[model samples]
Target: MPESLMMAFSWLDWLALGWFFACWAWYYEYSRRRQRSKRCLAGVMHGYRYDWMRRLLGREARIADATIMTHLERNGAFFASSTLLILAALFGLMGTTERALLVLADLPFAASSPSRLGLELKLLLLIGLFIYAFFTFTWSMRQYNFCAILIGSAPAADEKDSTPGLRKMFAIQAANVIDLAANQFNYGLRAYYFGLALLAWFLHPLAFILATAGVVGVLFRREFHSKTLKALAAGRDLDITFRGILQHEETTSESLKSQNK
Candidate 1:
């Protein structure tokens, strides 16, 4: 609302900013909806996670499972720590606004020099993005810790007291937990992609708009149409047969239990 801040951005800049946020929000919803009936990375990986939990229940030795979980937690920790460092650097940069403005002015592609307030606002936007990422990453870590607890409590394959129905339910619930944690991690990573695109805003609004669109396109390809997704989808088809075996076991166990009672 400051006069200088008002002068920093033209109508085109405002339009570009609006476009950036709209694209981000709209793509998020689109991906979420598309995954329900489509073959996306998130949907395919979730199927694999369910398969993993089912296999985990069948194994008595789970040290490898625990190690995998630890590695995932470490990844979340690394990202959260990195986000904090970047935020610190951005905050420090605020103290040298005059020098930053000079650097921008020297750039061949710089559209216009921003006022100190404008520069600060840009930094603030970056700060907000990273703050959201930090929250998501940290939350993901906590969820993974919860998953560890679930892993610890999971029923072994040979345990007579655990019925097949109970085991199946446990695997489904635990897989859901893992999927939730993964969703948080994905959200945090998406924030990083957007933050990188937002860097173009310092040069020109049009550049920022184009960069944001580019990031969204890349995300879309990787999520829904990449080689990785195709590979996973192929594997998921095999998983269907694997799940069928588990269902058969469940049904046989129930029949035996009913006969005994």
Candidate 2:
């Protein structure tokens, strides 16, 4: 490569690194606010909001009663979006490290006679990253399909009074939401990982490692160390159970007092 071209490439690489960090920081802050809200809300309210949030994020954007067309539409949208993202990440990997290694072998380095070992290492890493991206994308797609199925099969309001079907539907929807949320979380983590790899194209590989560690640390905090997880794990369910009992007691007391009066 010419001196000017190499310098330009170097500058572009640094810019990409800066952009990656900026985006990651923004997401980190956003995730923090979300976690804080989860911690502050009561169990009933949290459960309610969890359902609402799932619907809001869903592609269908509305609850429907077991419609085939709706399921197909939502699934198609989810698959399309996830597939595109996966393809983009794969393209980036191919255009960067894989291509760079190809060029590097032709240059004069200490062990530069084809460097078959280094080439194989680069190929393996690229393949692994591609697989990660594919899995994240595909799993999110599958979860969205599950969400579609849940929404489609939900019973009508009229049936709520006559059967336990409605409750079962809501429970299924809740499980689907959990699956969607978990997969979405994984997808976000994969995005940060890919961003780190992109940064590695410009900065030292150590920068990639640091970025990965930072992303993982943030995930760990949210998943295990955060107040939200602690609250949810410790007493949220108990509080909910207690609240139900208290409501029942209050209703009974009020009924007895009214009867005496």
Candidate 3:
């Protein structure tokens, strides 16, 4: 809209910010489609999650599984609480927006001092990002709660033979729930990652562009080529024979259970 509303950022600055968000959206879609087949960590982890649910079928003691779910919930809770704290700090800083900008303006490298409206605009953007992250983390926590419930209701080892169809169905559902929660937690983390880039806007538009690119590049490399991915992939036997068969057998467990009779 109005230039005043736009703040210190020019059209190019706004476009760079848009580019930052666009990359996030693009990666999300690409990951959704290719995760199962690709070499990305997400795909590998998805396989593990699926395999985990299948093994739950053979296990009698579930305390370990419940413990894992509790850890996931705790992670989500930590991020959700952290986001709220940041949001509160943002509101507090909003009152001194102009005063803070004046201090920055004194610095030689600091870009132009923003108007009050401009300062407010930037603070509002920060607040919005935190709010988004808060919601994503909280939702992830809820999904983890649901995952716990699913685990509790999951079929037992002996019961797996009796109701193979139901076991497979529950296994798939549990894996999906866990995957969805993990995805949401990741989304919140992405928001935090991009928020680092947004901070560069306070310095200068060019810094903003460079910072955004840096953030995207860092994230891209981690997802596709990180040493962690390589380490995770290194368990080729587990990856191929165990996790792979775990997934395929779960699909056929329903029919095979009947054929055994």
**TM-scores, one per candidate:** 0.90, 0.48, 0.87
Question: How many residue pairs clash in model 3?
Answer: 0
Weakest 10 consecutive residues of candidate 2 by summed lDDT: 109-118
Against the correct fold, how does model 2 do in TM-score? 0.48
Tens-place lDDT digits, model 1, residues 63-172:
99999999999999999999999999999999999999999989889777566777788899999999999999999999999999999999987999999899889989
Off by over 4 Å in 3: 6-8, 236-239, 242-261
Q: Residue 187 of model 3: what lDDT?
A: 89
TM-score ranking from best candidate downward: 1, 3, 2
Candidate with more favorable, higher TM-score: 2 or 3: 3
The best candidate in terms of TM-score: 1
Per-residue lDDT of 38-155 in model 2, one digit per residue for the tens? 4422222346434443344334434432353345345445644664666576566564665666666554431233234334444454555545555665565566566566556554
Better of 1 and 2 by TM-score: 1
Which candidate has the highest lDDT of all?
Answer: 1
Best-first order by lDDT: 1, 3, 2
lDDT of 3 by residue, 40-150 (tens): 878878777887998898899999999999999999999899898899899999988768878768867656655667667778988998899999999999999999998
